[model samples]
Target: MAIPKVFITRRLPEKCIKPLQQVAEVKMWSEEYKPVPREVLLQEVQTSHGLLTMLSDRVDETLLAQAPQLKCVANLAVGYDNIDLEACRLHHVIPCNTPDVLTETTADLVFALLMASGRRLIEANDYLKQGKWQEWGPFLMAGADIHHKTIGIVGMGRIGTAVARRAQGFAMNVIYHNRRRNVEAESELGARFCGFESLLETADFVVNLIPYTETTKGLFNQNAFTKMKKTALFINAGRGATVDEDALYQALLEGEIAGAGLDVFSQEPIPKEHPLLTLEQVVALPHIGSASVETRKQMISLCCKNLMRTLAGEKPITPIETSR
Candidate 1:
């Protein structure tokens, strides 16, 4: 029997490709670090039986319509906002994402960003690098206190619960707001469920872990920033679309909030002219939430496994249920 063809959108770790190659004819774009162009992706999908893609690729209806032999799309990340689900369903393409694997890793990054922003770590580092630290003054490099403060988690899912657990270590109070309260999470983590407004009003530090959905798109606007305390630090480890970038820029410029740490952005590779880039209070990262060597390897392996199983007519280990 002829083996099926699999096209990986970008270059992945050798371990991830090895497993897939065992079952299919794998063709990977040699340049893994950069995003594959749209024209190239469309051309590759034409003859592929399965596609392994990352968040960078926008798998829309037009691309789906061209892939007659495509059986499954295994997204390497947890979020699926880049891919059009309705188009997948219409084309009978199975859409899958790697969830649980990166939950803890992402949570760790959230806490890291929260602490770094709250304490002005980056700013202080710059001060030292610029040879400006002549001597330590009584009030030099002062930042907000993190311990024993209230932390408000915007979304109480797996990543949220993980972040709350870490907060407990600092003797901090964990308050959260979700679509619906998870009684089990409350009991296990001692997480207090509150309304969205209350969470913003009471938290000393606000952490956004909500996934990007139709309802959550542009959820964090000027009004939301205005609701937070002036001393409150904001951290985002979730999808960038959840925030209105322009509104956030205005809030920061106007001192609506103290500081912010952003892992993702409205646009990847944010332009040099972007207003947010000019802010001193913002600590920006290039979306490395699951960049840990071990975690990334696992995520890639899972995506390849999901693709192989779905193509082989076997149930995928982590199949995304559209009904939910």
Candidate 2:
């Protein structure tokens, strides 16, 4: 049998690349850290049977049209918003994503961002670096308390449950709002289901873990921020489009909320002059939710496994439902 041609968008770890190369003719785009350009991607896909893509790549109808031979697309990340599933269906292509493997790692990042924002960790470090911290005063670098506070979690999925489990150590009360309440979550995590309005109004720390969908786009707007307490801290480790960036800027500037910790944003590599970058109360990171060395390797391995399975005439390990 002829070997299937596989195209990897970015250079993955050697271990991950080796397995795929053993079974297929693999061509890597070479640069491990940056996204591959659209023209190059379209050209490469024309002859490829499988594509291992990252979240940064936008796999739309036009791109799919170029790859009539493409059988499967395995995304390295859990979020597949970058891929247009409808187009993939029309093209008779299977789309897969690495999901469960990175859930805990991403949850850990959410907590780290939450603590950094609530305790003003970034601002205090900058203060010391700038020689502004002469002596520790009673009121110096004071910030919101995280322990024993009410935590409102939006989108109570696997990651949200993981976060709630961690919060148990702090003896924090966990209340969550989901599209539909999970009875198992309530019994297992000691989480109480609440309405969206109540969650925003009552939580001391509002953590967003929802996926990007038609209903969830721009869910956190000016009105949602206004419902939060002046001392409440907002943390998002979820998709960037879930929050309105302009509204978030205005909310922080006007003291609608105390602070924000954002790992994901509406734009990746947000411009230096972006208003959110100028605020001391907001902590932003370059979208590294599942960035732990071990977790990333596992994610790549899973993506490779999915692609290999589909190409070998077996079912994908983690196939996404096209109907949803």
Candidate 3:
């Protein structure tokens, strides 16, 4: 019998690959920064038994139809929006994601981004570097205070709950809006569940951690921004498509919101000349919410293990539950 094969979309740490290699013949895209070309991935999937994919890889109906031997798809990140869950279900492929492992790390990044934008840390660094710090003044680089302020978190999932815990430490009042109320979050973290529009109008720091879905796509448009306090500092560490980039730009331009800290964008490696980048008040990061070395290694290990398990006729470690 031929050995089962697993194709990894990107090059990962060799230590994480060794266990999978022992179970299956493993092939990986040589480059870490560049995604595997679509044509190459489609070709590799033809005979592969399992796949370790990145968020950039598209595992749709078309690709699934071509992958006859594919049993499981383990996404490197917690969010599997890049992979079509319905397609995977129809194809009888087990889909897995690296969740819980990176929750705290991502939450840490979300808070850091909030602080950076609220306190204008990046702007302050630029001010000193540009030789504009000739004299210290009361209002020079003055930014928002985070302590004892209202922090309205959208999407009260694991990451959002973790963020609320951090907010508690900072003496911030936490309010949240979710598709359904998170009672545990409310009782344990002292979070107040409020209506979406009310949360928008209330929070001093409006943080978005909602996942991307058809219902949530472009959830933050011009009208949503218009509802926020003009003094509000908007932070999004969630999926980028959740916000209308054009509307966000206009909101900042017109002072509908004070500033923004974005980790994810509508486009990854957002174009240099993107209007959002032009704003001094905006601090944009390249989707590094779970980019810490320790957390990333855990994610890779989980992916490798999930792929290995499914290939060996065992259940995945973190299988995505599907209703369909």
Q: Could you estimate the TM-score for every candidate?
A: 0.97, 0.98, 0.99
- In model 2, the clashing pairs are none
Distance from true position, residue 280, model 3, in Å? 0.4
Weakest ten-residue segment in model 3 by summed lDDT: 315-324
Residue pairs in candidate 3 whose N, alpha carbon or C atoms collide under 3 angstroms:
none
Measured on C-alpha atoms, candidate 2 has an lDDT of 0.92
lDDT of 2 at 198: 95
lDDT of the candidates, in the order given: 0.90, 0.92, 0.94
Model 2 stretches astray by more than 4 angstroms: none
Of candidate 1, the 10-residue stretch with the lowest lDDT total is 315-324
Model 1: how far residue 109 lies from native, Å: 0.7
Which of the predicted structures, 2 or 3, would earn the higher lDDT when compared with the native?
3
Summarize candidate 1's per-residue lDDT along 150-231 as a digit string, tens digits.
Answer: 9999988889899999999999999999999978779987899999999998999999988899899999999999999988
TM-score of 3: 0.99
Question: Per-residue lDDT for 47-110 in model 3, tens only?
Answer: 9999999999999998999999999999998888998888888889999999999999999999
Candidate 2 lDDT, 1-324, residue by residue in tens: 889999999987777678888998999998977889889999999999999998899999999999988999999888999999989988989999998999999989989899999999999999999999888899899998889999999989889999999999898999999988878889987999999999999999999999998899999999999999999999999899999989999999999999999999888877889999999999999999999999998998998899899999999999887774
